[model samples]
Target: MSIITTATALLADIAVETDRTDAVQAFVKQETILVQITTADGLQGTGYAYTIGTGGTSVLSLLQEHLLPLLVGEDARNVEALWQRLFATTRATTTGAITSLALAAVDTAVWDLRCKRAGEPLWRLAGGHRREVPVYDTEGGWLHLGTDDLVKSALAAQQAGWAGVKIKVGKPHVFEDAERLRAVREAVGPSLHIMTDANQSQTISSALQLAAALEPYDPYWLEEPMPADDLSGHARLARSTRIPVAVGESMYSIMQFRNYLEAGAASIVQVDAARIGGITPWLKVAHMAESHNVMVCPHFLMELHVSLVAAVPNGKFVEYIPQLRAVTRSEMTVRDGVALAPDEPGIGIDWDMDAIDNRRVS
Candidate 1:
């Protein structure tokens, strides 16, 4: 067994392309916690997780001071056992963000190590259900964009062969949000899929109203209409709206997803691998969604999510929002609205060490 000889964690602050504002907060930068693990056999693996704007240092400290040391001298190949040990030892923070993020960093590194050792791409190693999954563009529809700009961007995405466009909701009034969706729908016509994300900004009543108002536009789904914790509210909205309910990005554990899925609160699962404590639990959620006859359309980290999505039979769409252009050498390939999973060994992210070193915060 190859023992974990060295483990390190660092924080890297990657800037967003523009000021991305939603109903809740403006995404200023991605505070990423990057982890590196080296085994006694000279094999190395890297993994990462992120915070939207703050607390990256806390995640890094959690890994360095509490989590990383646990892996030392442990069998690197025992990914599940190590993850369970970490999860149990960090039980104090079991249901929160910091612990999940820390676990993601370590768990993903272990997965990468396992895949590399087996000499298979992560998609194939995980479960090679398909090589290419459909893609949708979310960057073109930020809540701050003007109606004309939003229309133009949606049209451009459609012309570029994207599977669909996601528009941010939560304007000052329900009419304003409806008007924007109507305008985009009229421009893109009836065939193209249009998804709307409210970023967890509305009350249950407001979400019901907005969903009714936007129903005529034929949106594919209404995502995160209210705060993620409101399971009963989501169930009510899901029942009230004709549009499918999409959620799970804010959720941190398998049980959270189970609650949403079992309750029939969400039709589409937007499971973010990092936020759910890495690919280990990510696959668990995906399989669970599959068992429930639901679809998995993961949120963010498109570069990493593409492979995870393609690996599963129930994987539906990969959200297109590129973030690692500067820090990673590899980019996800999209052709005719479908994203091709990377065939390289391990997790498929080719990190630029110099860029990572330059941006390292801790």
Candidate 2:
């Protein structure tokens, strides 16, 4: 009765703030790929994946032309099996961003179906680990934000009871990034954790210098200090830094995490569920990270990640970046520096279908 009777895909082109810059690039638009599935028993579910700005149409094509077609007549409950099937079908596209993003859209829809059948929230059903994960503000920490503005943002986050505020590093000089971290630390007075994201924009040499300069300020973590592909370089940088190195937002697979963990290269694993396919593998990565004694503080899409983080014991901080307010019925609940995982049964998002239609691009 759980056989998937219908599967469909659509595109939502959402505009983001023009000034949201990281060390890598300024984000302009978000291409939200939404997938919906219906079971033979008449239960329905929706799931989605997102891209920064480009290649979203490619993801949509993969879904409509190839991936979504495979879901028909398949039991929606077979998460792992279906995921493997999709992976095998798209074997040529493995390690590619567009392919994984496409798979994630459908996989999350299937998860939404499973959760609905269980009558349990994803956080509890997935692991029942905990509800309230500590929250950190990344909206205030973009690299383009001025030092004075950085202080103001950090203080605002502190005043709002957030546990941490991330600062985007990678200025022209190591000292400039240090000065920004110093200002944020001074403004928050050291209790609130101050993390830094280099956005995988630095070279090994620059990362080493920046890490050394920021050590005095006691950053909670230094994230993506170099490119995600450079495993050996990351290992070397991790050895050199007293600060824990965090990575994996840009990574597209579980094997990449296996390599990082095996090498002791990254202390915090920022596995983005969308980029790594979906909730099925997301849990696998979380448990893998836990086994390695590494923390899991995922990158973005806080709407979905709040539940995922709450589902795992190794889950660390939920980065506060609200991206779905325009298309969702309500915002996620956060109070006193903690995010509460949704208690809803299906996928945890109350998507506004009309709004999604209005925003739909394809």
Candidate 3:
């Protein structure tokens, strides 16, 4: 067994190319926390987690002061056992963002190490159900863009062979949101899939009204209409709306997903791998969702998620957002509307050390 000899964590900040807004908050910059674990045999695996703008330092500190220390001298190949140890030790913060993000960096590095040791690509190591998963455009759908711009972007995405387009909801009025969806529907025609997300911005009643108004456009799903904690509210909305209810990005635990799934609160699972504590629990959630006959369309981190999504039979769509391009060596390739999983022997991204070093804050 290769013992973990060194563990390190660092912080870097990457600016968004343009101002992006949803109903809840304006995405300003990405504060990424990166982790690397080196084994006695000279093998190293890297992992990362991020925040939209805040809490990155907290995540970094958690790794350096608490989590990383637990890894030194442990067997690097024992990914599950290590994850359980970290999860149990961090019980005080079991259901929060900072803890999950910190755990994610460590958990993913272990997975990368495992895959590299086996000499298999992550997707194949992950189950290899398929090599390419469908893609959707969310970057073009920020709420700040006008309806015309929305239509233009949706059409451009359709022309470029994207599988679907997501439009941000939570406008001042239900009709404004409806009008934007209607315009995109008309422009893209009937065959193209359209998804709408309120970013946890509405009340149950407001979500009901928006869902009714959007029913005519045949949206594939209505996502996060209310706050993430409101399981009963989501169930009510799911039952009341014709559009399928999709959620899980803001959720921080597997039990939370179970609550949503059992309550019939969510039809599509949008679990973010980092937020759910990396590939270990991520696969657990995916398999759990699969057992429930639900599909997973993970949110953000396309470079990483593409492989995870392609790994499982129930994995459906990969949200296309190029937030990590500047700090990573390769971009995920989209061919005929599907994002192909990277064939490299570990987690897909080859981090640009100089770029990360230049942006390092702590």
Candidate 4:
């Protein structure tokens, strides 16, 4: 069957699980990108992007004014060829946030189509090597979460049988952030994995100081102590801190990941499925990281990532942020600390058509 006969885009807003506003980006109210593709046989695929806001509009503009014209009536099965065309089309900018986000929309749609055609879940289609992928709860369990809230969230995750929990550092004071981490460590104990993300919030010196202060608590990894693009800076921090530096949520290309890998910037790599040009390039990053003996702990889109991580031997933990529960048509099953990839064909997810119809922008 011919692929991608047509495509459409929309902007949507779904509430996050935590009323915890500080941990999320400031533009929380803005609707993000939602993309749907139709094939020649009338089969359709759907995907989305969760950029803070206005990302939906940027993706829509890029696709409609640029990529869609090229893709329409073209064989969607030619994912690699299409990727080359799209990437070449944007050669001036290459692959960055906007271009990759657009590619993510298309790449995800194509995979959805592939899954539907195969009548298997994305996980199975990606090679369902493992039924369960371990997860870590990320709900407002940070400095903003307060010591008590952090303890509550960590305890809840433990009680729910989660294998680990991620705490956010990067507050106004490094010592205060250390205290918050100490509280979480005390509550969860050492056996349970504990990770900390600085959200690109500190200077290298500050990150080093923070890492030292929190060193006693023993974090699983340190994420984005500086902006993700600061490769040299991250490498310096990696050298200084015992905590494995984890970056890549903000990175968009294999070249970017290569820079990090070559520089020894991060020990734990966190690839975002949507940010790195969809499943194709993400897998490349995973394989590359595997070769380097780096851990592949992907960022959000845990449902989609469950299959991806399970497919690779070097795959590590999947971030478990509980924001999509409200809007998704189906509930993702997460038992203990591990999540099971959706077994349904085509991304294993069906949009709440009624919700979509009601929320459709006129």
Q: Give the CA lDDT, 0 to 100, for residue 204 in model 4.
A: 78
Order the candidates by lDDT, highest first. 1, 3, 2, 4
Error of 4 at 139 (Å): 0.3
Q: How well does each candidate superpose onto the true structure, as a TM-score?
A: 0.99, 0.98, 0.99, 0.94
The residue-by-residue lDDT of candidate 2 on 1-362, one tens digit each, is: 99998999999988784468987798888999999999999999899999988988899999999988889999999888999999999998888899889989988998999999999889998898899999999999899889999999899989989999999998888899999998888778979899999989888888888899999999999999888999999999999989999999999999999999999999999999999999988999999999999989998989999999999999988999888888888999999989999998977999999988998995
lDDT of each: 0.93, 0.91, 0.93, 0.79
lDDT of 3 by residue, 79-144 (tens): 889999999999988899999999899988998999899988899999999998999999889999
Q: In model 1, what are the clashing residue pairs, if there are any?
A: none
Q: Give residue 97's error in model 2 in angstroms.
A: 0.6
Clash list (residue pairs), candidate 2 = none
**Model 2: CA > 4 A from native:** none
lDDT of 1 by residue, 1-362 (tens): 48999999999899897778888889989998999999999999999999989999999988988989889999999988999999998898889889999999998899999999999999999999999989999998999999999999899989988889999999989999999999999999998899999999999989999999999999999999999999999999999988999999999999999999999998999999889999999999999999999999999999889999989999999999999998998799999889999999999999998998898885
lDDT tens digits by residue: candidate 4, 108-226: 88788878888888776776677688888887474555688888888888887888888888777788888888888888888888888878888878888988998999998988888
Model 3 alpha-carbon miss at residue 161, Å: 1.4
